[model samples]
Target: MKIEQQYFENLLEEGSEEFELIFRSLFKEKYENLYSLLDDTDAFNEPMICAAFSTPIHIPVEQMVLGFLEPLPSKIDVVSNKHGVVHIPKLGYFYTNEPCESLEIRIKDNNSFAIFKSDKEVELISFKEEVYINDTDIEICRSEDESIIQFFPDQTENIQLESGLEKSVMHLNNAYHLIKKHTPFYAEWLNYTMRRIVLFTSPQLNSFASICTLNNAYINLNNERVSDIFFLEEITHQCGHALFYPMSIDRDKLFIMDYTTPMSHFSGIETDDRDLINAFYSFFPQYTGNYIFDVILDHEENLDEDSRLELIGRYAFRMYKYGLGIYQYQEYSDQILSEYGKEMFAIFREGYEKLYEKRKELFDSLDIKDQVYVFDLEKFKSKNLQKTI
Candidate 1:
């Protein structure tokens, strides 16, 4: 579902007094007109505006608001200086001289770059039509001097190499083609939610892709790992999180009714308070995975029998995971349904049960023995029910 203008208005009206004051102070004359543009702009960008109001960090709202209006850049340099200041040439920079709990950056305008903790602004020098930055005795050419760019972490030497960038772009193009061809709805969602994809060499060996809380999706797919199905799953999964994130902020307590107690999923992944909230709402991403496989299976003639079975197994596994998760976390899910009403829950339940039945039929036909992809529904359901008792 798309975020409407009224949602933005409600967000402003229901904001805390301090939030309203900062918003009004920063936006001044333009604050009233800003909400009208929310529906027309990128959905992912909405969270930044919400963050400007909610976050305790003393960020300049004018800069953040302006950055949202500008078109997202395809590439950006994530520069970390010797003084422990992380700079993203355009979007923002932060001081990380000491260890911190959070790694949030302060939003800055495209014209300026912050150096260290000095709060100094280094202006990009323009020569003819090109923009150059001469900072710390190093000179680099910038494609656009005044355009705001988004950056992500984990940019290692290997990831920054020209070859890696090309490979990442190629994977993205393949992903776009698959989304456009097979999942048109997801393509539209991507157009609205995904601003840009940033390539990074992930520190975690298994991490392939992730969406930063704001506008960028960070991917670490190498040449060998890049495939249409892989990219499609990653994009759709991350896009689901990106789409719902902004809504969670605007509609307070939309995902979780209680932030006091921690919760664990059926998979035994223990979530802390903050992460527990996210875990509670993870059904959307699982649903996306199931949806993608369903769409792909429609053209089963193009796939070999093994590939078809593999896709079916994945779909079944996602549905099983989602259904089992809901069954295990019924208390929390019930609260969410009661508060937000039954719309989302209805979708989750209907999809999960239908897919569960279909998966059982497929399992019998295929005689699948692989435990990784094929889920044992009866076993998990019985175990989950015992847990509740």
Candidate 2:
């Protein structure tokens, strides 16, 4: 894992004269260690390394490299020098460093550039600007007023940022505070797993928030359709998806294999199919809702009964959404028990029923209008369970 500091220093001191030899040796060693750490050896190819480093989450790459390298006198600023060449000021430079005729810079931005190199020619491959918030790099296109249009760098053409995007970011930060104060586990999980939240403008296509496991990020639409509680719900919900990544790594797949049919749920009049992993993941948002309710109830002595009721109702609605999913997937509980055992199933079923009961009690206590507003059970009913994929 250790990178030779003296060698890099010598490379920098000698500049282009020693660039080819130093870069080939240094980059090969550094990338091998990084690939080993990530459990991904294929990414060490020249094209893959170029692509990975150009993306926003390349901090993980920086982490792997810097983790073993000797500390420099000051932070090395990243800069591009020539075609297919990037200079890490005071550290060293990386380049093809060969005779070339046709050179192309595909894209050039302030922070990074992409280039293509061969023995005959070096060319600019592409370029992108990365925005960093709180030292975490984000892929976003900014407006004149500094408003953000966030999207995954790879899918910029398919997605666009919505109007009032700034407001959504504000709400996201507010939800982060609520999570940090109320759900310490989610807060901690997010610190390690969750990478970024990409915002989309089209409501018809992205009415509900979603998480993608491959990127370790959330993709949410800027639809002003729900309360702040909903934002917190999505945050915790997506964090749950992120949590499953590490949790599933060494686990047995028997339960999922046995229960391969998708579970149905309703967002409005439309029905959607959720896979076995997602059906199980529903437990997380329900757990998050219960945790938020507990935190509020812990301060019940200082609040009026009306305030308490409203808070409980809001969180209960969130819990009910996930509880309903669990209810729909209950038939597969035995399969889960068979694979994971009785104790695990018991713990899951307990939380599942507890949320259902709590939602029932909260709904019954409300007046007819409040009940109508809070308990939308119409969304939970599945017309058919026999449909298989």
Candidate 3:
């Protein structure tokens, strides 16, 4: 089945409904008859409830479930995870010492909240980090201590390093504006599914990397300076993963076999078929982004020669990488993908193949020789452009 715009609309509706069902079931399992005692069940719509459902924390599930208790306690001690932070829905996070479990929270007659720890009772401090980029609201935060880490081909140390939020925010704003202008579909997709942009750093993570933290409403990004094109590639890629993740919760209807069964090592590491399909889905949309750069080159009058080549180099470089993924994965896609999976894969494949053929001459003109090149403009020009002798 060819994927139309309606497919995304359907997918969003289906996935959201399924996640809510899963949450209700789990809530019932946790609270049992107490679940029926709730006065307002609509508290389930709180984002942190969904975040806790998707995230694996060291604390008991009751810790999260209790946050939804209709009449919150006058003075209750909420347990912190190993991260030294307590996450409450609607209420923000509270910090404490590590290895500490209890934070005494008191709700005053005025309904103001306070934290009593270390023999001191003070007003609770909550930092809700949020910003508006391209008129879209997004929270800027870091991955929780207990959240699942991103998959990497090589084993590397992952720790949150110093990130310059000012610069990163500027770059993201520019990138989102460009995405809104050129790849409006992806922009809308991101606005729908993405809620948070988590930041971290690893020295071995190279310049930059990003991954969707399973079903959590966030994606992790390496803290580094990167081009606008890099942001375009990553923002679209991880948001696609985040958008499609919830549907996998309904595994029985979506797959014929165990959805987690190891199926391929397209990234030089064993990955399940479900993940592989997501990766392919992630790559397909970037070609539209690649074409946008082509349009800018042909029509934009303000671009100097150096700026023009930089865009061209980015176009050629990404096309090669995206093309290679389709070539390698297309062979094995049918072996494991379900009918639904195959239909989606076909759309990705057909969409990319059309663009590849349409840009055949430009693709042939690129003399890129390295397989592991980043957006190295100087190297690309040296290899692809003739020198004036």
Top lDDT prediction, candidate number: 3
Candidate 1 lDDT score at position 154: 27
For candidate 3, the lDDT comes to 0.56
The list of candidate 2 runs beyond 4 A from truth reads: 1-158, 162-165, 207-215, 225-227, 254-256, 264-272, 297-314, 355-360, 365-389
Question: Each candidate's TM vs. the true structure?
Answer: 0.54, 0.52, 0.71
lDDT scores of the candidates, listed in order? 0.43, 0.41, 0.56
Residue 125 lDDT, candidate 1, scale 0-100:
28
Write model 3 residue lDDT over 1-389, tens digit each, in one string: 12355765677667766766766777678767756755356444334445456554454444544556757668765666444566554345666553345667777787666777755874444534234455774545432433323333222454442253444667678767776775577677667655555555544544322222332333234432365555555565555556666534454554455545444543355544546444544454454455555555556665557656666776777778777767776776665567876776676677667667767787787876572434566777888775311
In candidate 3, how many Å is residue 221 off? 5.4
Give the Å error, residue 67, model 3.
9.0
Question: Evaluated with TM-score, which candidate comes out highest?
Answer: 3
Each model's number of backbone clashes?
Answer: 0, 8, 0
- The TM-score, computed over Cα atoms with residue i paired to residue i, of candidate 3 is 0.71
